[model samples]
Target chain A: MIIIAILIGCIVGALIGINAPVIPYTYSTFLAIAVVAALDSVFGGITSVLKKNFDLTIFISGFFCNSILSIALTYLGQKLNLDIYLAALVVFVGRMFTNLTIIRRYYIEKWTSKIEKDDKELQQ
Target chain B: MKIKIKKEKLVMSITIGIACFALMLVMFMQFNMVKQTDITGIETMRESELRLELSSWNEKYNELNTIYQETVGKSEEYKNERESYEKTYELLSKELEQLNKALGKTDVEGEGIVIQLTDKAGTQLSEDVKVKRITEEDLLIIVNQLFAAGAEAISINGHRVISTTSIFSIGEEFLKVNGERIVEPYVINAIGNPDYLKSTVSGKGGHVDALKELGHETSVDINKNIKIEKYEKELHTKYID
Candidate 1:
């Protein structure tokens, strides 16, 4: 489910990037997607607060990271004058790498360590 | 007792699932908002720039048009001055021609008169004429025919209608005056001998009558002392030299 969610986010970001060149319509569509993404993030933050594990820095960092990445990607694409498809590809690559790194470090590696420590303590 | 334990596990799993989903949703929503703000900011800046560009273009166009109309407005005067210059040249040439003729030279003076037609009253032309309107092509044909009949000086409605003159109806009421706006009762005036000019202008199947047929009345007046005035310098346009 987490993988699917990440895939969906990346896909949404890519689609938004691809359609960014279409003048007037681009403005509305860009706003709509960003709003939806922000709402989803807010929902996550609320649940964390409810669970009493709320770290504003962590939540804020994630927010800034994705927003900055998306904007930087767009700006870099324009600065380099890349074609639309090429720009979309760049955004996709950037998003995928960042998401995978976060997931691996936070979920997989940490969980495996905790589980291994628990098994040793139980045997002792 | 076994059933109660299973129910407790089920409740815990459901709660965890809901909490996680809600947490994810919040995170995504916050990120999305920031991204949108950035994109909109960039777009707004770009749009403002485009508007400024468009406005500048319009200003330049208006400046040129003002210059053009001012120049064209004084066309009659320019034409008169040009004719005077040409006349002096012609007289000198004629003297030379006479000398050359005496010396068995084949040079001869090319004599001709320029005629112009104008409406005495500044009344709007009749419906038929308004419907047809005046066209550059029509003016060209008239000028060409006059030149063919040996016309020397040519002007129309106080404006030295040139090769570039485009006569087309503008909007619902006005005519395009040098791509600017102008109203009707266009007067066509010429400088030439009456007898020869009348005969030459109105002779055979002519366009003068065609203009009349369209309903905007046309009167070909012959002026023996048709002293066309000198054109004052244009106020808007400038010259590099």
Candidate 2:
């Protein structure tokens, strides 16, 4: 049921985005960093749900806070000529990979255990 | 306990759904923005570097053209062995010079008039009426009028008016003459009888008067000596004899 809701939301969002007016070139960098942060939060949310530790308040706060922090870091990087966004990108993407591994293992173990149980029942 | 669990599950699904929607929307918008911009895959160079490269290329071209002209002139002089050949060479050279002058390949100087056209000040014009800036057609008409009044050579903004020259609007803000972009405060110089040229362009109901009526600043000055430079573009002909 949740999967179906997410799918519908994505389709509607894409349609609205396609028809929306574009933002200026100057702010595109900030938007890009924010997107990476948001993507990390989504993956983390999925992992927490699989582990039965999902909290709505924590998820929402993480989503907004991560994006804002990344944008601020990008601005500071520009002012300092340091390219600090590279550091943020590495951290976020690394965490995303870890969360992805956890989600993958959970689904794989569930499917394998179900198959094993069916085989034992057949023998009995 | 069962009903409460069901309500919690519903709330969780709704929250996730909203987050996913926002994420997809931003992603799609970013994608669209990237596609719309034309700078993809092209590295931008510093402005100074680009300018230096252009100037060097132009200098090289000018040096080569001068050398080529010198060599051609020497060959014509040395190859004329017979009286008949020498006479033919003399006639051909004269014809070439006249053709070059007519084609705007040679610089010209004489008495003429200079006409200046500029946009009206924004503060001077009434808010209801739009101020008129000079257009390509207006410049073309003025050039035609000068030629009709016996002007021999003409130039607009230092771009010599030649047989192949084209003046057209590039956009609302700029006009292109002989494929080079030019901006406002256009100065047109013509070489001919100064009195005749001024009378033709600045007379009653002429182009200058028309421009003034549309709220443009216009002026004409007669000069004893005006020089029009040779057209800088190389003329290419494929089908003509």
For residue B199, give model 2's deviation from the true position in Å. Answer: 44
TM-score of each: 0.27, 0.44
After superposition, which runs of candidate 1 have C-alpha atoms over 4 Å from their true positions? A1-124, B1-131, B161-182, B231-241
- For model 1, how does the per-residue alpha-carbon lDDT over A1-124 read when each residue is reduced to its tens digit? 4345445545555545444443343334333333333443444555565556766556555544544454455556556755333444455455555545554566677689999999999999
Residue B77 deviation, candidate 2, in Å? 30
Model 1 chain A poorest ten-residue lDDT run: A25-34
Candidate 2's residue-wise lDDT over B1-241, tens digit each? 9999989878877877787788888888888887776573322543346568788989998999999999988877676556678798899999999899888999988889999998674534665767766789999999999999998889999999998889999778789999999887899999998888888888885787788787888899999889899999899999999
lDDT of 1 by residue, B1-241 (tens): 9989767655544443443443344334434544555666455665447668779989999999999889887897899999999999999999987664333233222233333333333345665333355555556667666656655445454444333445666454555534545444555444444566566656765667666555445666665554332222232435645
Candidate 2 chain A least-lDDT 10 residues: A23-32
> What lDDT would each prediction earn against the true structure?
0.52, 0.87
RMSD of 1: 27.8
Candidate 2 TM-score over all chains jointly: 0.44
- What share of the reference contacts survives in each candidate? 0.00, 0.51
Q: Model 2: which residue pairs collide?
A: none
Provide the global lDDT of candidate 1 against the true structure.
0.52
lDDT of 1 at A34: 34
